[model samples]
Target chain A: MTNATQLPVTLGLRLLRGPAGAVLVMATIFVVATLAFFAINGREAVSLFQEMVMGAFGDSYSFSETLVKTAPILLTALAVALPARLGLISVGGEGQLYLGALFGTGAVLAAVDQPGWILMPLMLAGAMAGGALWGVIPGLLKTRLGVNETISTLLLNYVGILLVSFVVHGPWKNPNSLGWPATIEFPAGAIMPQFFDTRVHMGLVFGIVAAIILHILVTRSRWGLGLQVSRSNPRVGATAGISYERNVLIVMAVGGLLAGLAGIAEASVIQNRLQDGLASGYGMTGFLVAWLAGQHFLRIIPLSVLMGGLLASADSLQLYAQLPKASADILQALLFIIVLAVASLWGRRRDI
Target chain B: MEYFATELLTLLFAALRSATPVLAVVLGEAMTQRSGVINLGVEGQMLLGAMTGFAVASVTGDPWLGVMAACFAGIALSMVHAILVLGCGANQIASGVAVLILGGGLSAYYGTPFVGDKIDTLGNLNHTFVSDIPLLGQFLGPITPTVLITLLAIPAISIFLFRTRTGLRWRSTGESQDITRNLGHNPVHYQLAAIAFGGLMSGFAGAALAVDYTANWVEGMTAGRGLVAVGLVIVARWNPWYALPAALLFGASEALNLKLQSWGVNISPYLLATLPYMIPLSVLMLSYRGLRASGGGMPAGLSVVFQSAR
Candidate 1:
């Protein structure tokens, strides 16, 4: 985005150029809109606003939960950002995460009697494969059959969610639980390793490392150049031997694999079981975070954390404010719209 | 044999009842697509409409008023899309997704109070009328008018698209904004009108679900039917005439699932639930060549959605 929002004449806007300006514009709009929305409804708008902030980062426990939420968002964001480098709009992170959990849990169930040393790797591998499978289907469909990736991914999400629902309610229901619709608890060996005695797991490391590695690869490597070229001009990239179709599958697979890790992490470290609602819309949040960061991998790290806090806080808001948790989606949408509008306005200025 | 015969008789009417919302949404989405603007927010618009329809109908006790309110809500929501995509020259896909998020969030937030609430006028299924045929007259009587309007809409929309001047203008704008501009007509105005019309139909569809039959307000009630409409528009190859059969395909799967569950069938409901979603995917895959060969199924504007048009 251009530095047009921060002009001396536009200094009336109170934000300087770059990321800070964008954030300022988005935050101001979101805050005012949210406050006005609640105030118009005759609620204690100011206190509710404070409750939202405190709910997000107020104390140690809240902060940890925020980090736990951050892990999945971070991983899923990477899953989306990677394919976006090749100009693929993938909204399948939710489905991929579910598939990852599905496959990862399958491994756990298959080798329920195995020890951790052997079981851990198997579960992770299975999860990755499952996520990759979900990603690859859409990628393959797009490259081979010319299906719209957005619609394909969205449809796959429903199928993936129901697939989990079908298994848990039918074949995989824990026999001892009687009527409860969920699988057996994961054995300790299969659980993702936690950090600092908190719910933050190995998935966090995977996400951070993946983001850095992707940043290096995308910005510093010839393969990354191929992605950029292929995104901007597939014909040109093909002439340069980039093989756009091959790259599409690779990026999509790797993206799905990362999201799969997040799925297994959620099942193992947080929920401790393969169950329905395993994703809880983190995949959607991840997709939003990826887009919010302009599909830049490194930037996705902080954005995911910030978005995680928003989601984490929303949970708290539901507890205290008597509001539904989906309220956070409104703020997220507002941020996206505001950022998009400002960025476009900046781009328009640059054109002149 | 008796049970099977009884199920078969009502299944057609049930499928038509269920298909109404999807068919309406498909027609609207097709109108938007035909005008060269892809409104992925149809799903969100439907949800907002469903919520508003339920909320207003329950409070006002007037289903028509609720439906009108729902339509306005949808139009207002789509205006957000128009502003972002047209005024800001933003990426249409991102803008559409943003609108979806906004609609979903707002509906969820505001519709919280209306959960599990039902309006008396909407529960048409509870007050059944007995008939000599058992299923034919009884099943088709109350919903026949609704069914007629929905079915009639197919030809009505088709005539608008293929036989009217404005319809030609909308299709031409979808094909080429530049050529439309050269022809001294503003593509923006045409696309905006098409989007608003799509939103109106989406709202009407949602209201049909809320006040016309179910009357029970549930959170996120449309449940991806709007997305199915997106695929149906493509599967129908952007032709409103084909939308009915395509919508019925989805509606039949859903109706069959409900039937099977009621009959205590051994099949997992979740597995059956996957059928409707699978139709568009399979159709999209199998009919790829047909879609492209028949003068390109996707609008030229939609093909370049990621890029800034301005």
Candidate 2:
């Protein structure tokens, strides 16, 4: 099968049956089909390709936007990753993101006169606290009340969105900004300073650092082992004298905290004010990313950046290719379809 | 007392409308789940069915044809999920999510042209002969045809799931695939049939949303109603019969939100909108007792892969 003549079929089969096949096939199709379109349009395909490459990583300015895009995805991915380690599906990150951004921005606005150091940390903490509370409620419901975490968390996301929408459009609406449901800006000092002469802020640093810390926490710590045991089999972990309840709570809190911080990063660093679109679809996009990358913290960083780059390039695609803004979303969906189709073929020789 | 009566009556109709879609999908899902397969693509299937139903109905100016389109559209969507999850043996959750994404994006793309275009709605069944009859006729008269059809379907589905040979085999497969094989029934065929049933119901549900309810298509209009239906199934403990009241509870909440909003309530519409989700959350939380042991008669391999004997 590995011989020269059979290489294409073998590779195709392998691609269909492995983790990397979906992205590989999608990228191949995208490159070929898009280049074909460019050729038909009498355009220079190489220049079009170069424009995408440059838009993503042409210089420090573009690279920084990549990091900025990655920040929310990274934290939202953690929102899934942490719960997943305990066999829980925390799909509520979207809702958590909204709540975190809402309250975090609210805290900062309320403390507008305060100095940066105090207000920033306070707002960030508030965001984390809000998200953690939201996540924990579902965990508690699942553990104590026997509720399904998946539905609880999923519903919570909608609730959070509505709650945030109400507050932003009502109490938190900036009095000065005629009817736009937005929070007052944080004090200038409260904003994370730009990393260079770019809009990128320390939030990216927080994301990267959190990824490293999470890697250590999950791979090297006793808590990590306990979570692994619980995820593998809750019955066995309970028998091992490890508190499965505690594990669930811890995982939910960690997931929520990470997602909440992502909200803070967006509010204080990226958007600088809370509004209806603050969270966007970051939560849902992060779920796909986390699921695609096997939910590993370290792997999430690069994968998220890749997705972020694709999203960032959507602007360029719209301008150059006349694609709709939603085109990038379609591409992401295609990637997921291809990836899942490819990955599911592994170890299929045996029956369930 | 008068206020309470009016609220209750208003909620009754509202619950019927809201519950109609959930009931449609849950009945279909209940059948599939009984046959030892889980179709997590209910959400996507409903979305596809909804958009197709609306588009076909609006274009043809016929609600029934629109509904037929919904069923076919839903079945087409389910086939993809059935292929990936049942045929290729992919992870059900992952494949379901993929289908959901596909359904959302596909519908949005096609539905863009039809946005805000309202069609003649499916009219009420309030005939003077039936409607003039005392209280019972009055209650059933103003009801939509979709709700009447769904109410009729409940008993028919219950009979199909419990009183039939196929139903027994389906139950056996979900309970124990080994027993099913020994009994000489192919589980995959049963699963496929069950999923197709779910697709049809989802399509009907979607059609009801656009043709009967909204009279137009909107991007992501099904909202999380599909997920709510799944939750209702669990809340009903996979019983085809119990899904009625459970779906009705959710519907009533939504209807109340509409009624309140119309009456010029100063409260945020978002908060009122929260009731539908919150009620389900409360139900799931309250019903958590003794769920860990047997899962309220959930199929043993409801979401598991079944390997057939060669």
Candidate 3:
């Protein structure tokens, strides 16, 4: 066949391959699981699903809310995707995000009298440092002590939250705010500026820029090539003079940096304070987004926005369908399970 | 000194009671890991079990039934894990996270109605014959049935692992799947069974927490106890016999934290609450070389399952 004629035929065959087939099956499974859950709850599945769709995409306000939510999700997803490239599993994004927010809040509180130009950069730097420190602990342990990064990161997540709780409940407790365990609010100057009269802030710009930068780094950089080699075969990579341990540390630091940026964005642009519920499963959701995008840095943007829309609709699920707030969690969980199953099946088929 | 002795005795009893649930979960994970699969879905499974146990106990007014429901719920969740990891050759770590999300979501979604609802909990066992025995009675007087079962499970699991033919088969499956397959034993089947059994124990642990330990239902009630149990398994070196002491140690830390808080210690309660998590991290780091030397008792076939597919 001619090159032009062969292209369409090959593309068609690829879609019929195992991975694509698995995706189709997973989509069906997600729909069925959603219906089953709604049925069990005694709600009409079709109507609730429709309401979810409308709630997420119905109006300009909802779209803006999704975009707002997407910024942090995108950043956190990058936190996961980067380390995953180096075959490291770092699920401590929740912890890293919290530490980032804590440090960001601390910087702003300390520099309340400073101008936005000076204070904002300091806050960002502090947040990134805090997250990097948290992330590096697991990386160091994994490389130096042979500690399992997965378990260590998971443990640190709880510890990080507890550390934050200790501060907010003790040293950082705002005397003016009645009884709620929270730090002082950021100075108005420290708050990030909104974009185009929408609630979406400068964080959205940061997320897009970061994603673009990471895409370039992953696709066009020597470090990225080294990372891939280490991930594929550590012994071979070592023979080829790639420093596997260094890659682990570097990837983890980069991952933490992204997650830290997410924390600063959420604290300054969204909540405007360091408080409990700051992480709120965003770290876990970011894992889902990264997995769904096959850990592709560029794909994280669209996938995060998609997940963000689903999360935004959760409020409407409570309002319109009378479902609990956890209804959204149920949907996300089902989608994640299906996607993982499909991906696994695809991997198996490729072996043949 | 006498007063201090009495306080220490009371703390020991509390630690024993608190350690029951962790004991169950760690033992279950030990069994799962022994069969060459790492199931990190324990936290999620425990949550689902806790919610289901509470709901069933309240609705049916039967604590035993609640325990059974929790077990089935755990098994159901673990089945998903098994299908993904064993059947489809999914990455065990990733599949585990997905299962955790599913379990957390399902429990939270369905648990809304049961929130704030109360039921007759499984209270302390009333063994009149044993309670009449002087000083020993004083020490064991407040023991609950679930705690007794957990204590019994330690020996039972140890015996099963070391003295049974099926146990050898399970161990071999984890050690070398190729050999097991050559011997006409399906390694995947053993892994599924182990995973299911693990789920059952996790369910019982959740039921114990809900119907025995706390006697209440709330969303995400298990907290991170399931994950803590996983760490405990590592500390115990995957031996159920060692798991008992490790679990008690964890329980002691928790009890000590509470005691300190009650005594109005100057430290932040949140910081003290972090002791359980921090201890495990420190233990892992300090014992890394020793653990590596011992191979952490991980099944040889277990680590390669994910890699081979990739």
Per-residue lDDT, model 1, residue B81, is 87
- Sort by TM-score, best first: what order? 3, 1, 2
On residues A189-278, what C-alpha lDDT tens digit does candidate 1 reach at each position? 998888788887899999999999999999999999998888888889999999988998999999999999999999898889988888
Give TM per candidate. 0.93, 0.90, 0.95
Candidate 3 per-residue lDDT over residues A170-246, each given as its tens digit: 89889988999888888888888898788798877877898899889988998888888888888888899998898
- Give chain A TM for each model in order: 0.93, 0.86, 0.93
lDDT per residue as tens, model 2, A1-352: 2678798888878776554555566578667655664566576777776776677777776777777787888888888987877767678788888777876777787788888888878888888888788888988887787677777887888888888778878888889988888777767866867776777777667777888898899999987888788777777888998788888888888788778878877877777787777757788788888888888889988988987776766666668776555556666666776666656654464233
Query: Superposing every Cα of model 3 onto the true structure, what RMSD results?
Result: 2.5
Relative to the true structure, candidate 2 reaches a TM of: 0.90
Model 1, residue B67: what's the lDDT?
80
Docking class of 1: medium
Query: Which portions of model 2 show Cα errors greater than 4 Å?
Result: A1-63, A349-352, B1-7, B135-139, B263-266, B290-295, B303-310
Interface RMSD of 1: 3.4
Listed models, DockQ each: 0.54, 0.39, 0.58
Give the per-residue lDDT of model 1 (tens digit) for B57-151.
Answer: 88988877888888888888888888888888887778888888888888888898888776756433324553344546676555634456678
Whole-model lDDT, model 3:
0.84
Number of the predicted model whose DockQ against the real structure is largest? 3
